[model samples]
Target: MVRCSHVHLYKNGKCNSWQIGKEDKKRMASNQGSSHLNGHSDIFLATSRDDQILFNGILFYLGQKYIEGAQHLPWWRTDGVILTVLLHAGPVEFLYYWLHRALHHHFLYTRYHSHHHSSIVTEPITSVIHPFGEHIAYFTLFAIPLLSTVLTRTASIVSFAGYITYIDFMNNMGHCNFEHIPKWIFSAFPPLKYIIYTPSYHSLHHTQFRTNYSLFMPFYDYVYGTMDKSSDSLYESSLVRKEESPDVVHLTHLTTPESIYHLRLGFAYLASEPHKSKWYLWLMWPVTLWSTMVTRIYGRTFTIERNIFKNLKLQTWAIPKYSIQYYMQWQRESINSVIEDAILDAEEKGVKEEGLNRNGEFFVRKHPQLKVKLVDGSSLAVAVVLNSIPKGTTQVVLRGNLSKVAYSLALALCKGGIQVFTMREDEYKKLKEKLSDEAGNNLILSKHNVPKTWLVGDGLSEDDQQKASKGTIFVPFSQFPPKKTRKDCLYNNTPAMLAPKHLENVDSCENWLPRRVMSAWRIAGVLHAMEGWNVHEVGNMMFDIEKIWKASLDHGFRPVTSFAESKAN
Candidate 1:
């Protein structure tokens, strides 16, 4: 007769070498694997083929008893009863062993299995405390088996309810971290030694993985030849190495940018809905504000500072210490240099002819000829306007920072098609002095004049600055600097220009403008939805609007009707 902790073989005498250590027992309890050692309950060993037969026998008997109790029910009802019970009970046991093995076999152990092993030794509660997904899988296994066999719905329900209670109690007992069962029970039942599933057994299952696959019954494991009869030393060796820790796996990669964008859009839609009423909006408003504030503060204080430190650290520790002052100075100088280069480059690079129009609106030519008359009275020619030139073309305007590369990009754009307007002579000269001759030539200079609406600094009025930044009209060809005046500009007749709508007020630009714009857009979208429009309808409308907008660019006409037609089509 084999004992619970010791295997007594008739030929080899008593094999007492398997006595579990006190530390191991304690470890098992702490880990929640010690719940299987109750004397009042029957323990099933799944290590050997004989154990598997015994477990099956128990399952069959349980099924038969359930069927016998429901014999008075109709045949169809009885079938339903048996199916439901088997479905409810069988899967839980099967998956406990199966998923445990699967987690070990698959790479999911790093994330899924490590939680189970948090206990070096097992305790009773540890049996079922797992990731939600793992728990669901375990539940599904039992659910499917019981549902399939039980014919009567009520019997199935009763069996499931009982099975759940039993499983819960047993699993809890296994991880209780204490051994309260009597030793006499084990002494009387010699084969019970191999049968009783102990915390030591289950702890070894987690600690080693190669052995102890059984849950309530060890018979399944024994028949399947998965039972590891080896000593506890083997279990200790299989534990995850500290250096090869599973924490290295990152789960963030599962999320994608598109998903994040859509989620944000959904939030925006929800927050903006009018019918959602004021209370919900009020609840969410703080979250939005806090997120924005935190992001900005983090960027300014941490991200920017970290960048400064990284750049300066290679040179000296003094850099990070003086980063603030250094960064300020650097930014000022760079801005000044960029402005100068932009002016100079624009002057040198002749704006190229962008395109010609048969309508004869300023010949529709590119502006490539760029000339900068320095404040010092020296002038520089950057590049020739290769495209056709129109008569009476004077002054060029440029966009972007006054850096050589920016100037060069502008020049490239001019060569592609855009016209040059005017170059600020004094600013141009200062820029040339800072750059090498070769790089100076590459600087981009635009032929388009800075719209009066855009010139807000110093000499300009607040109203003028606001108009320049927010004006929808493009500056006319005749408004090129060095010749045009405020009086010469027409208010409403100019072509629509693209300006940063959020920068209308200088004081408020840093704070209120972005929030206001975002809020407005969200509100608009929500209001649109509240009008009983579906998401698909909204998406289609947006798509149509975009199509028309693009078509207008190519056809030289704002095709509103065409947009409607496209949406309909």
Candidate 2:
């Protein structure tokens, strides 16, 4: 039979492959061309793996019985044994090359070899795994070596057993995924390097799939011109790696900001509602959260004044008559369109991009270099994240005519002693009309047109210097910085566009801040979720206001409403 060693064939219950849960296994299979098929479905009708293995085993035993009873030859006559052994190797290798190549034919690849390629890394026991039809083809081809000796009546069972054992030994070694050939051996006999294959040599075939298709030796690959360019270098590297621990990556859903928040909420809800009291019934808060998330389909729409309803038009007065879900969906679509337009506009204006993919799409490599934890979180989630910045950070910078919601957010940062830097006096005055009198005065805006001085500290390194960096926080509604400028002393929360991707979960509770100051809290939550800070730190800011600001950005969680006897600490 053709010696196929690179990829493993099957993995069911004790599978070390990526699949863990039943649902996930089925989902994984969906990507591999069988989206509609069930995970455990047999390859063909009446072709269960158990039945195939049993049938193949019966054939092997019968072959052995026939050889013993019918060969009628000495177990080991030196001349006959030698002749049969020499006769077996030549034709077996020749036929195997063609048969193996045929297996890669489009129809055969999908039906037969695709099952083998499922495992990118092979284990030794995975050697015999194959489709029943594939095994049948193998059995027919493997009989050539035995049939040649028998037809000439030159067969000795002893010689046949020795040849078969050699093939199995070499095949298992190829699949072991460990380099057993020492580097000194290759250096000692350079000619033997042409004949022997390493685990790394076969592994390239599994991962890259275009070259290195040989069973016993790479001689055919050399003659047919199918060798991979990196095979020899890879083989050398695998030998060096033999003494080191192998790298392994486990496949599973990683923790996210959403899952973290959900777990925390669920944990506290259960603690407060321990089984001793009715509060214990609040253990269902996660289910409630999930349900609200499932049902939350809403958005905040802007108007000439203020509109609480889900308004479609930008400047129209809106009444509280539409579903929140409809509003949120509208905002999602509007955001995507605006972002697309902005990107195109930037490109037209000759704005340079940092990173480009194969498809020629430009990526913002330096948009923000957040801590790894906030890599995939929403921009808005940062509004609620907290840092250890002193409660005395009181500077403001306004860049342009920003939304009223944004001004209110700047006001909150000012309350926490933050310094914000923004636009010139004319721009600040225009923005002042959008905010209420109390918020407008508290903004603490800084005029950026005037130049400021700073110590150079040119001779001193960062550690040697006595001073540290500080400046205004930037959370503009929209911004486009000049080419190649790295704005470090700012937290530019202005999104590229208001796309669905820009939002957190597309649910109602996603932005369920109280109606009176919804914009401020939402912006705060987004700010809070970024940097190395998170929602828990934001919670610390409201330790005294137990009833109002207990949980997360929305402050949605509360103890039993009637449990007024004692407030939770």
Candidate 3:
């Protein structure tokens, strides 16, 4: 193994770390995009045949100039090589600015430039991962600095070598996932940073796009008024642990067996002091083990953007790009059957024409004062409807945490229209608080109470009349609550339609342990069916599971299904 030097630079920040050295041969052969979990790629940093060809050509061209008495190359002349690099950047930057901008045009981005943007989280190698045409153009523009030195007869091999070295170094630094530069780097020099762009500044271009578009300097972006405002703070927090959203799939991720080996390191955290229950870790340990075993025995399902698969030319077990038809028949009438049965149940409760769904406007008879916009349907005439009331409607009826029902609600909130979410006084009050905190500033979540005819406004600051035509919401049940009168929160003479205490916790158990366990099994079901994991991915997962299994065995845990465990309980 080679020594891992250069750790000091990005040690604190979260960026793709790179070092100038020989790389592993095995990694290059696999040709995978990045470490699926850790998100890394070192192949781009390794010297390839293409680099040999380009550098050979450059050396040959420089060799001819060396014979023409260019040996001194301002070495002992009027000034130093740093002056030559700045001079080189001027013309190159001007030429590259327009070329780079042109590459972002729609057709060019799809065909050529978008390849670089394929990796949202970039590494040092990602810096040089441009298409052939783009790379060829880049090499040509970069050589202009050398060509000008030759044409003007102003520099030698040393100056040209140093100048090119500076260019490559800056390019690599821009792509590194870490921002090593301290705040005092600017405060100490002040003027130096105004010209140079930081790694985070360059990262924004990859993640956000349409801003910070200079070759190496920030001067052009400032002059063109295209600089991002949050560049500084974004850089500082780049390495910090991001606050997670409650509805994110990663929340349920099992990092235990993977990190169980690090028990000594995490022992303190597991032995909670306060706030968290002292027995929280011990209590959840068995639950975690059970959930993990269920998931391991089954498998997992995950989705990456289709473009990533296409761009990487990855070998997928399942089709990368999918049409609507691909997902339509997959459920095999199960969902259709459920909807039908639910609809039949609704009719029995005398729920006919309970609400007026005229054109796009809707008015529920139960909440007579409410006016709503009935947005388009989600699945099988199940509409996403939104409306506002006098004091504001809140308190949606769904309870269990992060189920299919909760996922649907999260998706509805993310429709770019939902501004605020309100919860009710229930057993899930703590969950509500956690969800609100994790949601961050993206949404306004509160514990306010409202009737069951829930409303999610369009999030516009304009008056209700002006924004009446645009908003979306969803009711988890097959039909809206059948409230015939203002005081009615349920259907007439039907206790099933009323709030039943027994059914409230049917989807879950104490502290939602059963829900979490079931969700793990559900994930396995998806993974077993999902066609994406390649042979290599499958091998890695199987290996991890073996280790987890051995670890569980040592702890007296015998993996068993809930059906078997429930009877014992």
Can you write out model 2's per-residue Cα lDDT over 203-266, one digit (the tens) per residue? Answer: 7766656577776677677778878888888777655531111011000110121321222123
Give lDDT tens digits, candidate 3, residues 387-498: 1111254334332233222334443443434443434344244334434444423344444442343332222122311222223222322211222222222221100011
Candidates' lDDT values, in order?
Answer: 0.34, 0.39, 0.39
Which model is ahead, 1 or 3, in terms of TM-score?
A: 3
List residue ranges in candidate 3 displaced over 4 A: 1-83, 239-569
Write down the TM-score of every candidate. Answer: 0.26, 0.35, 0.35
How much lDDT does candidate 2 score? Answer: 0.39
lDDT of 1 by residue, 1-569 (tens): 00000000000111112235677556545544333334522222122224433544576566657754433323344555555545433555566777777776535765565555654455554665555556556555654654444442444445555555766686766555444445567568856644455544565565555667777666557767777675234333323223211100000000111111112123444222211123444555556556445433431211010011111110000001111222365554533332233333322332111100111111111212222111100000011111111224332233323432224424443444444332456545554555455545533343243433221111223343233323322222111112123453423211111212222221111011121121111111222212222221111022122332233233222222233347699
What's the lDDT for candidate 3? 0.39
Task: Tell me the lDDT of model 1 at 465.
Answer: 26
Looking at model 1, residue 204 earns an lDDT score of 56
Collision count of model 2: 42
lDDT of 1: 0.34
